[model samples]
Target chain A: MIEVSEAGLLRRRSVVPALLAERGDMLVVAGLGAPAWDVTAAGDHDLTFPLWGAMGGAAVIGLGMAIARPDRRVLVLTGDGEMLMGVGSLATIAVQAPPNLSIVVLDNERYGETGGQRTHTGMGVDLVGMAIAAGIPQTMRINLPGEVEALRQAIHTSTGPLFAVVKIDPESLPLALPPRDGAVLSARFRGALLGPAAHLE
Target chain B: MAGKDWPAALFALLQAHRVRQVAVVPDAGHAALIRLVEASNEMRLVPLTTEEEGIALLGGAWLGGQRGVLLMQSSGVGNCINMLSLAASCRIPLPMLITMRGEFGEFNPWQVPMGQATPTVLEAMGCAVRRADAPEDVAPVADAMLGLAYNTFRATACLIGQRVLGAKTFGIAPQ
Candidate 1:
């Protein structure tokens, strides 16, 4: 059995906004389920691309964005379950090693969307270890709220493919859903990123 | 065009189409194209562990205003099924170059099922499928598919036949 350190477990609501506060020109990719809600709850922006159902793809998507727009910072916020599903992406991203990309896994230790079932993280799967092994330049496991500021700083300003596993309380929150229409969401994001010329295309 | 010229010609076409990213799950059939992409400093080659990651990667690439292609074997198609929904629903441009398996001079029984199902499955997921059975057909089919994908924001697949890839011999020693 894996023991979670509950003493300093951060609330998803507070942590997400704190990380995203004053985020300017940052393109965000939220993994499906809870992380999507967390990002929307923080504040839905035209630049935020909240995924509806792509379970294990958030990081690689962020990598694509980082590669495409090298000038902008790309942050992927996903759940531990989602991160574990696409863990191999760490190696892929590491090889490219785009300096503009950062991935944060909200480690709630359970698959919150699928009835709170315990995930591999709860069974002692270390995402940070896996990322480090995969050659990511920076890796962190954030168990305390104090560590969040440094993680947030690293996310906003780091020359790296940075990986952070943020331990959050598993307590379910109210669903703060984004628009369900994938096309609309994508168009809006592209418009926000590329301006009005995006819609002309 | 000779058999060896197809890969280089296809690479040239991808560059012409502004495909800056190439996501691939390494396969023997894609070896030539992969080598060209790797050797070129102009394109970024993303090596994926599974084929499904390529689907999402291409979606994100399109969203960021960069074109990309997914290269994989027929067997990897099964891995991409669920992820294809993202592209199909959002109208993300996905250009897939899949090498055929289990259709001609077959040695492995394991490759048949998904290989046969590739077209139907991709079509059902809203991808336009086109096949290339000979060396000469490769470039034109790829060019047409890339145009369909990027121009109309449609997911397209160009399935290169096993005959074009040269069927693998049975019981070959490991290199």
Candidate 2:
């Protein structure tokens, strides 16, 4: 396993909050493990559906949301390991080509949740290249803090099945869990989106 | 009812139940249904590379306040076992239309294990399995499964028998 140094990598705690700051009613789906905590730390809102499990399901869930609510921007934040597990989903998302959806992979180059073991990304796997190959219209690799604003704009306003791999530090941080109960999270999210009619459905 | 009519009937039943999304992995058994979904402008047809992705896709669609269905072969059931836990545990409604294989004149030996195991596996995963052995039974079984899934948020499976699909010949080209 190739060792990833934490020296110059972006802090997930800092990047997630910044990206989500201008989120105006955008629905968010956070993948399992660190990405879920990252979104919760950013701010736990009813609009954010954070997965307690379902390791590789985040992006496709975002795809479903994007398809259901075309007017609302849907953003998926997931770890590199999780993204790699369901990487084939990018092709499906691209084929459907929902302009409202964007996927951001927090590529820390390791599986941080299961102990900092180096993942395929650390061994030179190219996630952005894979996204491009998968036919996503827009793809990027963000290594600098300054590039995040552009990604934020693209996510909020671009015509895309967009994908980005944001390089982050491998350093462990405090756990910030959202509601663990899947039923509660699902109901709360649906209620927030559909109002009183949520129960009727 | 002819075998060709069952796919359209099933599609109509799904529409009546307000299933706006159809997530599928390509298979000969589900080809007609897939084509029907793809041709429809009213429903979103999501073609998945693997059957497991269909499980997540449908779950996500449900969470987003849309009803969806998964169409796959019996062999694909193995691929969906672990992912089905998400729907089962969360009580997310999953309505699956599975086509049976490896029974009643199946030529492929590899398909037997998973095909024979499909119903038991789905049952273990908390899905109520209903079988349709004849062309006429497809729509009613599908209707009941959809009702069970959408009205009560239960995981349900409608398994179409291989006899309904007709036995696949080893060498002869299909007419």
Tell me how many clashing residue pairs each candidate has: 0, 0
Error of 1 at A44 (Å): 0.6
lDDT of each: 0.89, 0.88
Give the Å shift of residue B16 in candidate 1: 1.5
Error of 1 at A155 (Å): 0.8
DockQ versus reference, model 2:
0.69
Residue A20, model 2, lDDT: 95
Q: Write the per-residue lDDT of candidate 2 for residues A1-201, one digit (tens) a residue.
A: 112345877788888988898799999999999999999998899999999887778899898888889989999999999998988998899899999999999998999988899999999999999999989999878888788888889999889988999999888999999999888888888889988787787
Error of 1 at A94 (Å): 1.4
Candidate 2 regions exceeding 4 Å error are A1-6, B1-4, B172-175
After superposing candidate 1, which stretches have Cα over 4 Å from the reference?
A: A1-8, B1-4, B171-175
iRMSD in angstroms, per model: 0.9, 1.1
Candidate 1 clash pair list: none
Best lDDT goes to which candidate? 1
Q: What is the lDDT of residue B68 in candidate 2?
A: 94
